[model samples]
Each structure stands twice: as C-alpha cells, then as structure tokens.
Target: MKNELWQLSACELAEGIREKQFSAEEVIYSVISRIDEHNPRLNAIVADYREEALIAAREADRAISSGEKTGELHGVPVTIKTNVDVEGKPTPNGLPAFEDLIAPADAPVVRNLKKSGAIIIGRTNTPELSMRFTTDNPLHGRTENPWNEEASPGGSSGGASSAAAAGFGPIHHGNDIAGSLRCPSFCCGLATVKPTFGRVPAWLPSATAERGMLAQMISVQGAICREVRDVRLATRIMAHADPRDPFWMPVPFEGWPEMPEPVRIGVTTESYDHPIHPDIVESIERAADYLSDAGYAVERVATPSVNEAAESWLRYVGNEIKTYLMPVAMEHGSETIQQIFEWFFQIGGVSDAEDYREGIKERTSMTREWNLFLEKYPLILSPYLMQPVGAWDSDTKNIEELRKFLNSGIYSLCVS
Candidate 1:
C-alpha cells in the first residue's frame, strides 16, 4: 500500500482491488492523502467527502470478499464538478447566493458513476454559474493549474481538470457546453472527450426549470482523466442508462463496428483570419503526423465552414444565454461575472426573436453539412486553442481580453 496508488488509472485501481492486491480502502486513503496535500493550494476539490468515500471503499472491499459481482469502476475514487447534483450536496454552481441550495437527489451521471462502484472523494470548483473560461468564483475562490499557477486550469470545469492533473484521483466528472470540459482538459494537460449530445444522460434535480434549447443540445456529461483509456472507461460507466433523461439512448458504448483499416482523418488548421500562435499550429501538425504514422490516411481537408458554425453558435447560443442565464447572472453573479456577461453580449450580439428563429433554421443546415462531411472523414483533427494557455484571469480583466480569449477558442464553441 504505497501512496503512489493515487497515480493509478481507474482501470488499474479496479483490477488491483479485484485481484486482492490492495484493499479499496488503501486506494481511497492514498488518493485522499494526495488531495489533502495539494488541494489547499490548488483549491481544486472544493468540497471534501473523504469520510464517506472511505466508508464506500470499505463496502467495496467487503463486496469483493463476499465474491459479489462488482462494477467496472469498483473502488475507484473520483470527483464530481460542483455544478452537478450529488444527492444532498449543495449545487451552488459558484454562486454564493445559491450556497444553501442542496440537491434533493444525484444527477443522472452521478448516479451512474455510483452504480459503477466509483467512490466520490470530493466536488470540484467551477466559474460563476459555470459560464467563464477560468475557475474563479466569489464562492469557492479559484482553482489553480497544477502545471503553472499563473496559467488557467480552464473553466468552468477547471477544478475537475486541476484535480485530475494534481493526481487527486484518476477520473473526474465534467460537463461541457461550449468547452467547459475540453478547455479545462487542454489547459491542465489531461485527457477528455466532450461526448456527443445524448451519448450520456443528464438532469439536475435541483433545477427549477429546464435549460435553454441550445444548452440542452450542446451540453453533455464527460470525464476528465490523466489517461485516454480511463476517459473511455469513465465515460462508458457514466453513459449507463438513466431514464430521467429522455435523450438517454440504449446504444452500446461501442455502438459502431470497428471502422475499416486506414481510417481517413481530416486535419484543419484554419484560423479564420485570427492570428494563431506558431506553437499551436506546430502541435496540430505534430498530432496530424502521429495519426498519419499510425496508419491513418490523414489529409488537410476543409469541410463545412467552421467560421460560419462558430458565428452561428456565438450569435444564437449567445442569445439563448442572454434570454435564459442572463437574469441569474444579473441577480446572483459577482461583478466580474456580470461584466464578463456584458462583454460576451457585446462580442456576440443577442439576436431578436425573429433572428433567433432564423438562427435555429440556419443551425439545422449547418448540422446537415457537418453530418454529410463526417461520412467522408470520420475523424477531424482541429485546433482546441489557437494560442498557448492564458493567465487565469485573462477573460475577466476587460472586454478586449475576453474577446481575445474567445477568439483563441473559436473551434471550441462550435463544431459540436
């Protein structure tokens, strides 16, 4: 039982627990110790649940001793983003005003994780209302990037990314709508996938009303992990059936058969007139090369207009945000979040009612073009961030900085 158990992936931990090489309690202790050592400075796991996790771990060990069947993630310690419901825990969503709004039940993904025998060690931080690109809120403070304190950990799932990178646990729960999951993973140098909408069920027991249509379509639950295999494992576990969400499909995790050999991958470095950093371009090229070397027929091919899709996302989803989320930001958000919202409104002008309808019509056409293109190229390698990671507070300093920040992630907001 070494402290290095915290470094094991979810798959390795589960295997070790099943083989009786280590008790589930030992793994939980190791991860909790790691969190205790680093989370004070990182502020990654904002709410500690180590005691409950230990109890769950002991139960998992007993289940093994009894020769009971176990789930795929048995005994693995993980963290949930603060915005998601975890029965009886407060889902403040980085707003102090909602600090007392405890969830009556676990969100769908949380329940699925528990069913997979994953033990929740803590809850991670998020931006105010989970809207910003960095994880800093008046409620829980900021989550620092483990690699560089000054650089962002990426938000609004920065806390999850930070915790994963810090070795607090192997798998962390995160949701993305416009890069919440992807951006944080990119910043913290972790692995994640913004699962296609409907791939995983989602619902918040604490929500007073449903989210906007765009939010419902774009937002998805995902896992942030140190390894890609763990991302797949956690995502598969989280994707288990949950009847609460109508979008939850019964499709198998590996629904599609294996693709033909030499899969054709489309590589695009198009910056849409924005000045992309050389390092970013180099990274994209390097990845493309790796894919090509791995026997994939990689080619630099342009599909539909990403710029147009991004613009539509900015104007349409932006308006949806203004219509649904702006009131909450106005009423409960901090001054910084409020100002950022205003700047977002300025950069992506809110559409009038007629324009909103038009945007939906335009979105359908855009989706069709992408679907048709995907039939030719199943995978596309595109830039996540056009520049290197920015400072933690770059998006909130002023409107210009925020605009620059958004411009750097033009690909992140769209292409869902």
Candidate 2:
C-alpha cells in the first residue's frame, strides 16, 4: 500500500486524505521515497525539499483533523520548475552565475498552488536560461528521460516533465514560452495545457527588471501531470488571481455556455516545408476520427497563416533576445549555449529597430486573424511538433539541426 501510494493521482490522494483513508504524511513519504530511488539517474529535481514538504504535510493533516477549510489541492505534493520564483529559493534557470539570485517572494503561480494546499517537494531543472528545447545546464547537468536517456525529456520545462513521468509528484509546475509545457509533456507521455495568456497570473519577484514586451505576451504559466483531470485541477488552481500580476483575468475556468451539440473542430496536418513524420499524421487522423465519433464536427481544413505568424514570432522575439538576453548569455552562459544563441539569431532573422516596432503592431492583426478563425471552428487539432521527440543533443549538433527543430515547432511558437 505504501509503495502503491506513489501512483495515485492528486485528486485520489486529496480525496483519500479528506476521507481519513490516508494521511498527507503517507503520501509525502511515498513520493520522497520514489524520488530517492529514481531521481539520481533522472536528475529531474535540482533542489530537494523533502524535510520542508514533510512538515507542510503534517500541518495540512492537522488542519483537516481540526476541521479547518481546505483548498482544492490540500496536502498534495508538487514540484516547481527552477525557472520561477519560489520565495527564498534561487531561480537560477539553469545558469550557475545566477545561483545565488534568491527569490524575494513566490511567483503568482507558486502562491496560488500553496494557497490550494500544495506542498513543494523540490525544484526541477531546465536548460541554460531556459532557452533551449532540451533540459541541460551547467548548474544542474542534464535531466535524463525516464524512458530513454538518449531521448530528450523536452525543455525549457524538461525537468518538470521528467518528474511528472517518473512519479515524483502528481503535479509539476512549469511555464511555457515556446512549447516548454507542451513539448516536454509530449515527449514524456504526460498531459498538460498551455493556458491562454492572462488566464494564469505570472510574475517573478526575484527578477531585477521587467521582461521584454514580446516575452510578456508569449510566455504563460501552467503545469504537467499524469492525468488529464489533474491537469484541469492544477491549471484551475494555478489560475487563481494574484494581485501581483496585472494581466490576470477574473474569469471562471469552466461554465462557458456549451457550444452547439456537435462542436466544430478544425484539423490540419500541413507541415509546410518540413516533412512531418507519418506517425504524427496518422495520430492526428485517429484523434479526428475519435472526436468525430464522439459527436464533434471534425474537418480537415487550413486556418490562419501559421508560417507568417511563426515568422513574426521569430522576428519580434529574436530582436528582443538580441537586445536584452544576448548580453547576459554571452557573459554568464556556457560556450555551447552561447553558440546556440548565435544559431537562434541566424535562423530567427533578427529585425531592425524599425521592423521590430512594425512587427509588434503586426501581431495585433495576426491575432485578429486567428481569433476570427477560432470563432468558426471553436477548436483546432494541430501537431505541436512536426516530428517525434528527438535526441537530447539533437538541437545542439549544428545550425541546420537547430533550424529544423525551430521550423518543426512553428505551430507551437506561433499559436502561443
């Protein structure tokens, strides 16, 4: 029973705890034991907080015993990605130079999770500056995929994905900028949702300055979990309003009036210049078939210009990186990461100052096009990455490989 406790979902554990079938301590112990046994090889968790988590669990159990009101995630163990602020912990984001940059307060998502009764078991790893498509850093080293060491677990949230897949906890807090949440989940066979921007509040209290305009628009906070229900639960909890984040919306998670009986779903398998894997095409088809059988009106049709949107993402974000992040990377980042950033500039087509300003305005028009398209279809079934998961070092091999990788994820980068 103790061993099997590690397999329970967040919902199951919470229900059991509330019903007095299991204590939060039992769940925490089980998860810590799992981490102790498996994390050495996986390197998913960068900072272990087993002692802190156990104490929190005890407090949570006492609260329930005293008949105090509890939040949705009462006594549940979760891991936070190292990139975000966790108050007093370092948000290194995989760079050794920033190891001592301790957070002054919890990020909005972390605060929301704690308010919901979630305990942080540990902080997970990420690539240097959380920029790459795979997780590896000079500070914490590489996070190995639980299934295969050679395959990437996915990044910038690869550590979160690895922990989720390896059963370290039911919920793993991860943020997405460019496929960080979705890519890792895809590689690790977990479920996740890259919540629409402003749906979840985000603010890194440790940061010395504000992020670039494009960064604020594209990046979003979310989670990865083993079960869809847990993803839904975690996302809702994380989406709770925090006064720190001005972008947060006071919208309900559910209760959107039901769409007509058969919901319209637009399905696209278009890969543009890149050759999409056959399995991906087949998987999309199978999903469409299943949706159709489930009474969704599935149609294989093109939507907005993904290529153009992707180009815009590259242009706008590339210029921002060049202006803002490049200096930091050059000074404190690894030689490999420095080279990777160069490749990014090459393929991203960094725009001039005038073009960058124009690109920012152009984003509104692009978003309008997508919003209009989404009105008719309501849902779009599209590939997150054109190909299956690649090797850990696939993107770092050469400029061409990195370019291909960026191209494959056009949908992910653009859609967000």
TM, every model: 0.98, 0.98
* Weakest 10 consecutive residues of candidate 2 by summed lDDT: 253-262
Quick one: best lDDT, which candidate?
2
lDDT of 1: 0.91
How displaced is residue 327 in candidate 2, in Å? 0.8
Model 2 per-residue lDDT tens digits across residues 192-300: 9999889999998988889998899889999999999999999999999999988888988888766786789999998887879999999999999999999899998
Tens-digit lDDT track of model 1 for 95-177: 99999999999999999999989999999999999998899999999899999999999998999999999999899999999
- The number of clashing residue pairs in model 1 is 0
lDDT of each: 0.91, 0.92
Q: Give the Cα error of residue 139 in candidate 2, in Å.
A: 0.5
